[model samples]
Target: MSDTAPTSVVDQVLAAVSELLPEIAASAAERDRTRSLPRYVLDLLSSAGAFSVTVPTTHGGPGGGAAVAFEVTRLLATADPNVAQIPQSHFVYLRLAELAGSASLLDELFGAVLTGERVANAQSERTGRTVTDQTTRMRLVDGATVVDGRKFYCTGSLTADWIAVLGRDEDDVEQVGFVRAGTSGLTIVDDWTGMGQRTTASGTITFEGVRVDPSHVVPRQRAVTGPHGYGAFAQGLHAAIDVGIARGALTEAAAFVRSSTRPWFEADVERAEQDPLLVQRFGELEVDVRAAESALVVAGAAVDAIASAPPSRVDDVAREASLQVAAAKVLGDRAALAVTSALFELGSTRSSDDGLNLHRHWRNARTHTLHDPVRWKLQHLGRWSVAGTPPPRGPQF
Candidate 1:
């Protein structure tokens, strides 16, 4: 697998990011403080068609696949992880439109993202703590779906133009749907102040008889899989964020060590780069980031192959993709946690800046990794390996 950015365009995209980093990083704490992505920067990225990567070529998009998305995410996240993640959900749903749904739906979905519209996920809940407890109920009323539930961790709800929501069917099966902005009964609680990923605006959204048209609902029979199953797009998104977070941590650590003027113990080391320990840790983190990127590329290839091949071949490809995606998530999450924790150790004493809010890397990794640990995913893979049985088919996440 050629590990370089696949095309000149991709290389161009990567290069353009450097000039934007200073401004992007400058806004990181403020976005976290405000609990939202800076509007103007998002507009810049959207106008550049960053969100168009996974859309099919016929749709007038980049058609760059997961590898491109992965690189773009890491590059952007090197400045602001929260901002990088904000658009990830858009890409995942775009993948859905490309492979399994209608072109009209694609236009309705990705079009909004391309036009600088934001999105959020109203999946996680507050009280009914089970992984599958989607207390946010929806019912059909007067040609519209009525929603009534509270969603915890509703990222970007305050600024979202649309939200991809999951709810239960009449027979208790699950269905994924969308709720447009300004829908009646949709309310956001301004209460997402947190320890990390604050720019995510991950507040709670409550739906009380919110009305959505039948067109907003993804068809029942069209359900392929939820976010956390074999070949699940959600795992790909998770892996992207994990890699981005780790890469961002390493970048911050490198900058901090190169310029910190503070003293350490009996010696005023002056420069963090001068420390042998820092060098060793940086080398280790570099290897980890490269490994995660490679794993993601392999997973992307596997997904594309499965998506392109016969149905009989799909299961095998999906299983391979799932294992690799889970492995990537686990490795990336661990790498981010390890890298950030080591930075703090290298810093010795916490300084005022402390290198771009280094603690947020650890916090973001913890929150994302804990969402559905890659270890549990590994256990599922193990069951498939040991029993000669494919992992269960259907959306569990």
Candidate 2:
């Protein structure tokens, strides 16, 4: 039940990422401008075996943990948040498959991942009463399991090799079905118009009686009674994205001020970097970014601890992990928003040029942080602080 991939493969992927990131970063602006899928980067990572790193050591993968994936995600986010966020549900599916405890499901899904196949999420629907609510149905038509419904915010669906959909079966039990990318009656639309993460292609997906191989439909999200990290792990990865956005924005801001920005006229400085006010602001922003970064790593470690906690202490450890992740997410959200907005302010009018696309950072952060409301994150933190209550368990925590 490890999303903690084998350690060795994880290390190799991380090492390769060090070389790929500069290339990834160099193309981000253009990709943002065109709203192009960061297919180049996605292919690069897949080729480097990033997706395969999470395959269980028992499956012949170099063993590692979710902490490694978080680090890799943080690095990817620094270069391109859209690409960084896309594969979230892919790994989440791996977690789900593990929870199902089905040997066949694990081999099929993990083998696909190892073969560089990508799974896009088709889980959310606008018509649902709540985010977790699912109305999509998987029905037995004569013999085939057919899916029929509409999904919104189907992130990564466009570029994905496979689609993982959450639906309900005849007994009103929730289930997840996997469909190949080009399955009949499936329609993927490129209609997302959000101000940020545009390349994510998180738009409309229509499944009209699309057939899923019966073997590909796993019983969804098995209930785990013990202290577990089912939700904390997902939230921690989110924090990693925010960390990347904050750091990336700050990095770009520094470069802009040093080479492209003008000095404040009142300061009579030759360069913006020499202006004491701008320097002070940059230092403060760096401190915020680094603090958020630290929180992200701590959150990852806390979540990792859950994987090994003995049965007696697992509950408390899991609760602590959730709390730590909530803190990391709060810091990440604040840093991403504050620093991204500050990037433009410090860089002046020139920074707003369309060609530079510096604004995409703020736009991406604003759009993404809105996806999972930050208010709930604070509410959990406050509940834990004042009432000595553990955060309620779920993806929201």
Candidate 3:
């Protein structure tokens, strides 16, 4: 947990998340096998107010900040990584609205989300190469924009009621838009079947002459640069997922070591936990987990400070917040990998029905970290710090 003032609402959120762990774990295998998120789980999350944390109180939302969101995500991830990640892409767009001070948009978008309407990201493409080159083009036609393009890795597409899409304008600058699900000329092609997070239902979304009203276009008058952007929020959430993976791995390993009796006893050892090396390994993983979590706290504080600042200080604050986000992601990602690997090795189970999904933790951690590897991102941050050059722009944050 981050060392900040704990709100009752945050505690309520944690309680809601904690209560879902059993259901999440129970459904993990089914979700992976089916390659789809169960509708019931999503309904449960909506009713719990999970998606309303970023929206303002005046708008009938929880009015929470990035840190509270991080905690909720981490808790959910401890049980099911796929389900935990499903809400992040939508919440990221909501956070963007908050940063932009687009309260009207937030009210409309979040009201729908609070009623179980899922949202997804239609940004990443097979050949969209950079943020500047949006392969998807939206052209003005009569009173609306006609969209034609293919978006890849559209997580939660199976359940989303709307998708926030990025397209190229006449000037080739990237702009964001929203299209309601089940709209004409829209198609969702199921394509995701990865080794991990298969339940995310991440696939390809196609828009062929999909008509979007002018009001649906997310304006880009202000260049989203400097600080106070998506990067800060993403780092905090990614770090939380990393830490959650570690915690899950450790918990599984600890339970296995404590109960599973083995026959490879040297003298009088009855279980793997009796081994000195296993004990030492557990301690090492615990230390790494704690360290990574602490780094996340520091990063969260940096993000909160920047988010609370006046509009004039946003750009510089965003840049500084970027560094902290990178640091947290790098450290937390490494710790998750380490702890999960150690847990697998410590567990001496040979059967697949050991009632422990050790490999899933590592697989989820490995796959999700690719969203933006902390190592490369850290180098970018260092480059900005040393060269005093503007950091490269990415699709999110």
State each model's C-alpha RMSD to the native: 4.1, 3.7, 3.7
For model 1, give the RMSD to the true fold: 4.1
lDDT (tens digit, per residue) of candidate 2 on 1-397: 9898665657678899878989999988898888888877888899987766667787766555668778888898999999888877677666766666467767777778888888888988888678888888999987788999999889888889888888999998888887889999999998888889988857688999999877778776563334667788778888889999999999999999999999989989898899999999999999999999999889888988987899889899999999998899899999999999999899999999978889999999998888677788889889889998888877566
Ranking by lDDT: 2, 3, 1
Query: Is 1 or 2 the stronger prediction by TM-score?
Result: 2
Taking the tens digit of each residue's C-alpha lDDT, what string does model 1 give over 10-59?
45555666667778887776666555556677667766666655556566
lDDT of 3 by residue, 263-354 (tens): 35663666667777778878888998888788777777777787677888876776666677777788789888897777757776541343
| Whole-structure CA lDDT of model 1 | 0.67
Q: Whole-model lDDT for model 3 versus the true structure?
A: 0.74
**Local distance difference test scores for all models:** 0.67, 0.84, 0.74
Best-to-worst ranking by TM-score: 2, 3, 1
Flag regions of model 3 displaced more than 4 Å.
1-7, 34-36, 101-104, 130-132, 220-223, 261-264, 310-316, 349-357, 384-397
Provide the clash count, candidate 3: 3
Q: What lDDT is reached at residue 95 by model 2?
A: 70
Residue pairs with colliding backbones in model 2 are 4-65, 4-66, 5-64, 6-62, 6-63, 6-64, 7-63, 7-64
